[model samples]
Target: MNRPTYNLLWRLAMPLVLARLWWRGLRESGYRKHWNERRGHYGARGAGWHTLWIHAVSVGETRAAEPLVDALMALYPNSRILMTHMTPTGRAAGHELFARHGDRFVQSYLPYDTVSKLTRFMRHFTPRICILMETEVWPNLIAVCKTRGITVALVNARLSERSLRRAGRFGRLMTQAAAQLSLVAAQTERDASRISSLGAPRVVITGNIKFDVAVPAAALARGRFLRQRINADADGDSGGAGRPVLLCASTREGEEALILDAFKAMPERPPGMLLLLVPRHPQRFDEVANLAGLRGLRVARRSTLGQDGADLDSAVEVLVGDTMGEMVAYYAACDCAFIGGSLLPLGGQNLIEACAVGKPVLIGAHTFNFAVASDEAVAAGAAVRVVDAAAMLAQARQLLLDTMTRNSMGAAAFGFAAAHRGATTRTVELLQGLIY
Candidate 1:
């Protein structure tokens, strides 16, 4: 215990401390209460089990693992599963997926990585094999699992160049922690070699699981219903976009400025260009609305836009579809989409959503979160990666002018997504191997 303390003591203490400082920030947030409730109650009934534990952080990772989780459930019918997450969005998404398993799939908030909390979590789940998505390595989490002799694997693992450089500056504790994983199923060869440089062993290239995103029939049906409600064709199915519906979705804090700039700069802004700007976080919705107002664009809440059909096409009412759980409908109606969270310092967003719906996808080169997806999409001609606001405007304008390129890109995008549909199978295979 005296040898460097594995750094978990500090890691576990920081969150509780930050939670105290930002108690006000999370005070009005329903998610805070929801996560705490799940941590305290849901999935706590069965404390001990031989479970296949999978941990994902939030909405993105949870969705990325959806296909794999379904595959695992079908492939290993007898295996009980434990799914864990830190954030409320992740907990909600996990619950939606895992709840149907009843006694089989249990979802919970991951306990803090304190010795005691980790001990409790381990005792409760008793997972023989731990599957972690992306970069979810805590020193205590890994060291304790190693101490307990539970096999652990990293799936769809990626170590960003920026993250690696930051780890180097921080004395590489993160890298050291990651090395304790038994196997690393990396998203790319570059990621594999880089993590190996950071001391991870036996890294294998498995491709990204997000590529295996399955279009739910229910989601498609729901999208159709919503599209009909909006006076857009419910069954158009991305063939011959009846109109120019531009969905500026999943924008992070800094990305909106670039989007707004491009929108305002468009000479004779293409007719029927209905912009739906959805920020990445719920808290920022009003902030982004205010920013849009400052840009001299009339803003309309999508809810309000539906209620009142005034200014459906005008300098007023850029529809704000600011609600969660409706992204599928939003994506389906969007003729083309600008996947945000990338234009500035935020890296990038899930361009996969647009691509999944066969909406011609646009992105800024700043995406580090889904690097392989972005790269593969661009390589497959399913996406256009731009450098800045100016470049984004240029690319978007070009697409607007050239319907043929947009249609071809949309087809290629769908092809790229459909072609990489085997991660769920690969993941299922490994998971079955674990349980059996």
Candidate 2:
């Protein structure tokens, strides 16, 4: 009912959590890679120099942290950053994202929320300040940081209605945990209100940091090359001439079946239409590829391609994007993008990246995870939200069939992305007051 009780329960659940991790490691090896780090026994690597730390839980959060990380690196010229992630995907993404600045950044798993581990982690890092990206709320971590006089802030903070309901189950603990946050830079007024209701002391609307993600020039170039290759293949193969590529980005479990079913039912798709199905979790990559194959589509895995190569066969109906850290490239290589996880009640995946790359975007009905951005994008003529798989397929067909409409939507997508660009700046300014 309160912090103490919650802490005790969490401790009791530790074994089950470890067992879950072990089971997950059976599928995803990353869960098994850094057992000690998760337990707060960091050994020599934990003995760090710089005190500034940023906690990004998974791949999405890690990618969103990029611009903020860049800003932090610039703001603190001589200091090193200790980046933390809960998932191995996030850890890998952190390394890939900051590979050039290897010496300036450190990546590891944030310790499990327990007193002993929290104490050890704090003593090891001695962090001056910590930035919690998105909604990574660990009561023990926050309480310990507050006790140690470490500034803890949540950047690009958001609270979906569903998340708020879940947090309400432990209202007292959540309120206490939230109250300790030095700052809550929320992405929207709705988020600010919910976070405030949860007892976050200082909440400010800073928009979503994801709007500031820059599509690398190399990604765009590679995307263009891949498109050209597809076009070349189409030209050579009469069976596949003049088709468009549609990317279904970050699809969840049940949604893939619907998408594949709709695609199969559509007998009059464009001449050589290709569907790029990218599931949200790496563990589902093989399963999704299998789904595509079972649907009688000629499926190819993106992982099989050589570096910067797009030697896909003309007969391929669907391409399974089984690779990591190249989402922007997938968006750029497509004529239109569909934001996944929304077809069911799955609270949609981020569509900001698709818009940032100047692609016309589509989404399913549910998008509460990115509610404001999705609504605004549709209002701005940059995105289309369909109620079901059939609707999504129809919209995708229209976009592929109508070049003028798609081009206009793409232009609007760029403008919409550009209009929401100052979140990173606002976030950095807020953190400056706390740390600088």
Candidate 3:
């Protein structure tokens, strides 16, 4: 449909959206807490100041924006930040991550893509410029920003082949929305081509911002501590060596089942081995934990563990990572990481964190969401791709069993990450042109 019709339909779906939020609130109470912000009711926080608005829809995008956010804060010390998110998890993550910024780092839910609400939000924030993290191409929002002469840029932008094909359905609207963007700092050559084809006037390949994320030393120490605790427990009285840890990071809905099936069918289920399963969404923590139990695997909840409760019993096959903001720790603790979302056509989750921690990564066939980076990592010998559940199991098994290969891959992963670290700087330079 056209832009006006799209807006009309979106406006008509307001009740449904609110209902969905209410339903989500039942599971994650953060949704229930930010009602006014969702309606564009943010009051005079940056009232007469130059507010630099950034929209990071959910947790992943919010995390990915961290490096860029750091650069922005350094460059524009006096300018206030108005962070907007669509998910409560994203908002909470922003608060947790940028807590030191205090009032200068404001956060709210981005309003529904309705003209009235967006106009209200625009008026409230009165931002000098807007930076969308990735893949949030709202026609209404872009059009409004353009009409108001507010510069808009899409940083760390990535347009997958699947996404571009889908956007083709709403050709005119997509093109119009793209045209409204002043600049797009795409993550790769493919993304730049796709976004330019969709009608962005200026598109530059700035590389992926995620490459710039720094893993905290504290996180690494905590991970090592956790691993030691689990090792001590799994080793028992046998004085046997601890089993290698396999981290299934950010596994999505069908992915957990696939992974568990692969684990069950392993030709060699190494003794004392532990699988750390971290679901992508917080709401699915219990569901994933239950899924593991249903698969007949002995499960331990990360949330329930005390500081010293790292010693896992040999019987415990899987540890449910029910906590948030500890991905680095998980990566640090693991011998090999299977970056989830790739196993079952969900377009794969980010593997940068795994690389950042120098862990060998195994991703599934469908990494369209991160196509270029995955391919680059594989070419760099930093990561390996598996076709499906069975292949993942086999590859993970090899990596776990073969320490030398794993270490080599891990070194490559770290090297690849280090080599790709200048994206944030280039993006910040691009933003400088727009703001200054």
Candidate 4:
């Protein structure tokens, strides 16, 4: 399909899309709050021109864009950035991330990918450059930007074999979109090759920007305090004196049930071990908590705990991390971390954060989303890949009991994270060439 066909299909589906957004708003009100922006009607709020515009669709993309955003801000001191998102969660994450910058960093919901809406967005923002984080290559969006003389870059880009196959189904629509990109700073050579196959004319290997993201000092301190609270001993002297914590971070929909069942079925669990379950989506926090309770496991929510987790019950078997923007803290607090979304075929969530926090990492078989990182991390002795939830827990049990191996893996994980730094700097340099 070509641009015209894609646009016609998009226009036809706009009503269904709006209805879905409205339905999602019932669970997450942020979706409903920015209705006008969805229609490309920013009005007076979007009056000024931006130097750079970034489209980071959701939370993962938003978070991945953080270091690159900072680098861009530093490189262009007086420039304004227009951040766009497709999800309320991404918008919220961006707002929290760049809140200190005030008006210099503006955010809006990306307009629908039709010619008119895309044209309106481009006219309103008047951004000289558009940087799309990860795999966001909308046909109409790219076509409109190119026509309007906007330099579009797909930075920190990645493409898995599975994604390539899916994109192949769209044929010319995907190829034309990729061909329109001025640059694609891919995370790996494999990604560059895959993107090249999709017809991106200018692809470069700039590594993964996520490795360059700095762990906030405050997050580490918070992690220490949380660890103390989570591991409070029998006598209440909370100085790393309690049970070992196994953090199941960024777990997806079906993986939680598998993990919970595995945890319950473990015949030889580590003595006084606590499971810290953090779901990937905020809307499913209550659902996850209920899942734990239904399994007869004593569950406690992070949201209900006091400022320092003072009200945390000592007898709790599972701790549900229901908060947002605290992934670093969660990683730092855990003894070992299991990266989720991989147990099934859902592609894995980011395991780099856990490694950055110097924790032993556990991943599942499916990690195509982060294929290079996962394989390299496992090869570096920083991470171990298990086949399923049972294997994950079994491995976790062994790691929890073996302190020496765990500590060694933790050190390797930190080293692995440090070794892959400077992607942001490289990407910024390339972007500078485009701007000039």
Candidate maximizing TM-score: 4
User: Scored by Cα lDDT, where does model 2 land?
Assistant: 0.88
lDDT at residue 50 of model 2 (Cα atoms): 61
Query: Which 10 residues in a row give candidate 1 its minimum summed lDDT?
Result: 34-43
Residues 1-436, candidate 2: write the lDDT tens digits: 7877977898899999999999999999999998998998977645546658999999999999999999989888887888999999999999999877767888879989987898898888788898999999988898888888888999999999999999999878888889899899999999999999988889999999999988899887767666665553322121235458989999999999999999999968987799988999999999999999998999888877545555667899998999888788888888889999899898999999999988899998899999999999999999998999888888988888787888899999999999999899999998988884
Number of the top-ranking candidate, with lDDT as the measure: 4
Model 4 lDDT per residue over 1-436, tens place: 7767877888889999999999999998888997988898877745454469999999999988889888888888888888999988899999989988877899999988888888888778888899999998888888888898889999999999999999999999999889899999999999999999988899999999999888999988777777777754422222245777899999999999999999999998877788999999999999999999999999998877667537467689899999998899888888889999899898899989999989999999999999999999999999999998999999999988887888899999999999999999999989999984
Clashes of each: 3, 0, 3, 0
Off by over 4 Å in 2: 45-48, 232-242, 306-310
Q: RMSD, each candidate, Å? A: 3.3, 2.4, 2.4, 2.2
> At residue 228, what lDDT does model 1 achieve?
55
**Candidate 4 local lDDT, residue 20:** 96
Off by over 4 Å in 4: 45-47, 232-240, 307-311
lDDT of 3 by residue, 1-436 (tens): 7977897888788889899989989999988987987787765554677789999999999998888888888889898788999988898889988878876788888888877888888887789999999899898898889878899999999999999989999979999899889899999999999999988999999999999988889988778766776773221111247767889999989888988888887878666678889999999999998988898888998887656654667688889999988989888888889999998888998999899888999998989999989999999999998889889888878877777788899999999999998999999998999995
Error of 4 at 168 (Å): 1.0
User: Measured by TM-score, how close is model 2 to the native structure?
Assistant: 0.96
lDDT of each: 0.73, 0.88, 0.86, 0.89
Q: Of the candidates numbered 2 and 4, which has the greater TM-score value? A: 4
lDDT of 1 by residue, 246-286 (tens): 77788887778777877888776555555678887777778
Candidate 4, residue 24: the lDDT equals 95
Flag clash pairs in model 4: none
Model 1 accuracy (lDDT, Cα)? 0.73
